[model samples]
Target: MEGKTCCVTGHRDLPQKEINHVKAALRREIDSAVADGFTRFMSGFADGVDQYFAEIVLEKKKTNPALELIAVIPYQKRLDSLMAKGRTYEMLEACADVVVMQEKCHPSVYSHRNRYMVEHSDRVIAVYDGREKGGTVRAIRFAHQFRKELREIPVGLILDKNRTNLGQNRI
Candidate 1:
């Protein structure tokens, strides 16, 4: 599925009010990607957007078992450091493949993982709020540099439907 793979990147902490909208957007993108003949979805397994992306991909996999969820972990220690280890572990257990980018944490480990994902993926789906910084921005820049197809979920756009009480809950 080299040519059919898509990787996701997003913020680790989303605004509490926009969580539901981000999730809905992610679901829509994943469905659209699947419909377009994409089968393998890659995730960084980070807290907010990455976990949400992985969750939605797994839900899609229920109906289409051919869909594969790949975890591109930045470092071996990342799992241990995450606050939502239980949820992350569950996602890891369900993933079709997991690639630990680094055995130890370093300043560039996460960037390396992001580069790896962008390099291997034919398309990139990003949940970005138009922020000029952070890993999501770097990933998006890499996607441009590599000339990958990019579909973005506009986090900065505040829709009335997106304003809800869905606080900081994990799916």
Candidate 2:
């Protein structure tokens, strides 16, 4: 899985209007990765982009048995929170492996999980706005340091599309 794995990182709270566009981009990127021989996809199991990645991978797994979804959970508390979401719980149930990085929550647990994912993955698919400084940014930086192949779906692209649509509506 070391050389054939792809990990995903992104913002947890996405603009509701951009969900479809983001999903489309994710599907395209995932398909491209499959074409490039990536079989295992890992997700941090966060709310927005991570959930979308897990759901897409699970859906693809139904048609392609070779594809695997690995859930890299940061801590026990975070896992509990995710389990409360029925969709995420179902996703977890369908995962090939669930790795709990920490038993208790720590300041560095999320970063640790991000590092672990990048370390094990050959590529990274990031849904970033290119401005916010958070876990997503840190994960992308790790990808660069580790020299992993990166495919970014910019949030700003979706925002620009919305603006264009708004402008056209006024015409």
For each candidate in turn, give its C-alpha RMSD to the true structure in angstroms: 6.6, 3.5
Error of 1 at 19 (Å): 0.6
Model 1 TM-score, 2 decimals: 0.87
lDDT of residue 47 for candidate 1: 83
The 10 consecutive residues of candidate 2 with the worst lDDT sum are 154-163
C-alpha lDDT of residue 131 in model 1: 70
User: Candidate 1: where are CA atoms >4 Å away?
Assistant: 81-84, 157-171
> How much lDDT does each candidate structure score?
0.87, 0.92
For 23-98, candidate 2 gives per-residue lDDT tens digits of 9999999999999999999999988999999999999999999999999999999889888988888999999999
Scored against the true structure, residue 37 in model 1 reaches a CA lDDT of 86
User: Where does candidate 1 clash, by residue pair?
Assistant: none
Across residues 96-171, which tens digit of lDDT does each residue of candidate 1 receive? 9888888899999989999999999988999887677789999999999999999988785433324433442432
